[model samples]
Target: MHTSHAHTLEAARYAALAREDHAAGELRPLPNYALSAISACCRAQMAADVPDTTADLIAVLDSYKSPEELLREAEQKARSEQEYEEQQRAATDMDAPNRAKRYRDVGTATQVIPQLGWSRQMVQAVEYADDGRLWLDSNGTARLINRAGVPGRVVASSRIRLLRQAGYLRSENDSEAHLLVTPEARRALYLADLHPEGIHRDDRAAHAARLKVALTRRRGKQNARNEAARLPRMDVWAMRHADDLPATLTQQREVIEEQRRTEEEKATEKVCTDSIEEFAGRIADHLDDGWALNFEQNPYYLDVRYLYLVHTDGRKLRVKGENCGRDEQGAALPAEKLKVWAILPDTDRPIRSDE
Candidate 1:
């Protein structure tokens, strides 16, 4: 009935068509076509005196200017949404895959240190630097949540040493210090410890603002002192050997022994593999030694044999005259001629739980 309502309905109709056309894979919307269609439909309704329908049609057309206009708007909105989602995913990845919790206080943070002997409050959040130094988030503010925290002092040192020796932590950053832990170290710390109490150290709040070097960074200075303690007392041999040949012989012997051990392992592996193949082959061929076996030709021989060998390490070998090829004597076969199949040496052996 009202002109404004009729215009609005027509505009809405055009927008609906434009969206549908976009979904139907239009290269670009023909805005003029959409607008004309809506206008014609509105006029038709008006001529019929269906004012309500006319108003609706007008509204639909007015909602969007043209098909081209609607396509551009939708594309922009979609792009913005996609960009936002990508940024969110990137942020999530930086926070240790699926873990989001931050360790800011010593009490809360110590739960992350593996095998650390220091009190919870002394170790702060483990941090990495551009230069190789394990910075203990000691008495410093956490950037993640902006809270103060402290790392265990002594335990941090010991743990860093262990990590370095374990070859998990590396001196990649190469600052004056020996090693730098990546942020993923936090996840490693989480795997090491999960504390029930929070990390806030009430007593150390005053010292919480200070940044700390991991105990590993101070190890060089401590090792200097250890060198003095390690000084060995020596006795000069008055009756020395005529030459250094004896010492050289001892070093050569060590190398020879190492090579021998390596060769032995290879030989053992070969023996085990050979045993498995021999046992498997005998079982696949239905012939028990000396026995006369009668059987229809196997239609699925390979499939049946594969199943028989499944988990062979657990079962004991039992050779019987089960349809093996008939022998020259035409008598039932005995187990002995079957070359008593050896079980895969180490595999067939029971595993010790302690091992």
Candidate 2:
């Protein structure tokens, strides 16, 4: 063997041993494995001809963390987050009195407008505001009445204040009441028949960049929600067709298949429970009405007796495997093949399906 190759191989061996020792070191209370890992690491570092394996090993040793350590860090992070949220909630709660006081000095309304009518004044005011819901107040300031009794604040006075604040409207009207759509708003909002005027309208290329980005973010969230609503149906469909599953499914089939089986078992258990209840109920009702139990030995199967009840009124409760008599040609009818899935109370009584 070549000398460099021998050195590389020895270094690789020491590196492997170091990793093993490091793992063991974390587990034990004493520092015995830590010393062993350090010794192995030193040997690996000294004998290494090139940097590759040795560098990788050093990186692994420096960065690798145990499952417990990772879990503890996660728990600590979660606790800190919870504490921060609680503090925020507490601060909000404490400030509630002051918050209420802020709104207390607000004035009461003298009269309620039965409904806002689409008169010429209201129409012109809405046009001026560039907002449909807005109407001129007693002072001629454009306002939106959300609450019936409470007075609404000005959305536009000499300018469309609220829309400008929302970035959907801007004023190139400059010292005038009329407002203009922002370039971002022009791209995002579908304003038609309103003022064609806008800030940066001359720059035809700057089409609503900011509003487009905001809309994209909103669409991203909505898309996430859409996938959230859709993806569960895949698991449901997979379980529904579990018996006919193909090998192409990437989800762990062992766990999914086991869950499917468990669900089937539960369904089977419920059926069994229902059958037992039906059986006991029928037997109780029959015995109460003077029906007698006839345990007759089977013809084909040795030592097996069919259990059934007979009534003097020509009504008979037949066991599933009971002989309903031989076929027309007198060949023994296959009694064993009769109605295996049928439960107890195979009655002459009328039911909804019968009706």
Candidate 3:
């Protein structure tokens, strides 16, 4: 048989064997046999052409790899490509302008004297000089007077060049070739002053008076209205003594607080004393000398106290009372009414009243 026909028959036999092996569960070795059969067929085809050789076919067969290995290599190649793309994206992001940093750089540039190692005083001098002109020397170089008002050094050529480039200075060729200070340069030479326009009339006296009234209102002072009537006099005194405003306000607040506290304490004392006296008078009218009145202040109620009226037989009645004239339920009680809540030493439950 011809070599080409023999190769085809051998390939067909191997392919059939590979299929049989796969059916018999020899799956791992099947691909190797199948690839060998394919390689043989390819070589047979190549041999049919005279100039063509089996070298290409042999190389393809020699370079065969398992499916798992080939899949791993493909995944690695994809990961490499993805990583390279990410690196390029990150570099592009880094090259974008940072607005915050650019703003800071602009502020720094605006504050400092640009291009020349001159101090702020020198810049100010140039701004306030008689002519404010930068004259050019015969060599086409700009020159400026020294700090002592003597024509000494040539203006830094680089500084003049940079100023021109930055639009802070322009060359005016009228009458003489001299450098003209642009509006931007004039603005840069501006000296910021607290009293830029002129000194005005002082309003500290009025300010202090307003501050005092504001503080009094904030503290909820009872005499704030009465004190406002004296604001004019207070303003005059505050201006004369200037530094005493805070101290005076503080003293007034302390005095008001002290008076309020003293009034509250006295009111509370009168309420408690009068309630006991009135209850004692009522007891004197109804009961004999053997009856006694015992009482203690209630801890929970701010303006309330507890009273125990002991009878001759030792039966005690408990009374609750408020100095601010209200009951435990916050209902308004008569100023003369002593609230009787419970009676003790009962045969059954103690008699109780909500009033």
Q: Go through the candidates in order and give each one's C-alpha lDDT.
A: 0.40, 0.40, 0.50
Which candidate number maximizes lDDT? 3
The list of candidate 3 runs beyond 4 A from truth reads: 1-264, 270-291, 294-302, 309-339, 344-355
- C-alpha RMSD in Å of predicted model 3 compared with the true structure: 31.1
The TM-score-based order of candidates, best leading, equals 3, 1, 2
Q: After superposition, how far is residue 6 of candidate 2 from its true place, in Å?
A: 50
lDDT of 2 by residue, 1-355 (tens): 2555555465466556656766777445223333444445555445554343345544564456678876897899999988876674465442333434322311100010101111223223334435434454555455654457333666534333333443544444344233444443332222111212222221121123223433456667556444322211111221232232222122345669888777655533322223333443445443536566554544554324455566667666655633332344534334333322222344554211111
The best candidate by TM-score is 3
lDDT of 1: 0.40
Give the winner by TM-score: 2 or 3: 3
User: After superposing candidate 1, which stretches have Cα over 4 Å from the reference?
Assistant: 1-62, 94-201, 204-283, 286-355
Looking at candidate 2, what is the lDDT of residue 172?
Answer: 45
lDDT per residue as tens, model 1, 1-355: 4664666567677767777878888736655657566666666566556754546655675585677877997899999988876675565432322233232323333533322322233234243322222343333211222223222232344434434543345553333333445434433344334452433342133122111222344656555345322211111221122122112334456889998777655533322123334444554454333332111223343111111222333533333222232245534344334333323322454211111
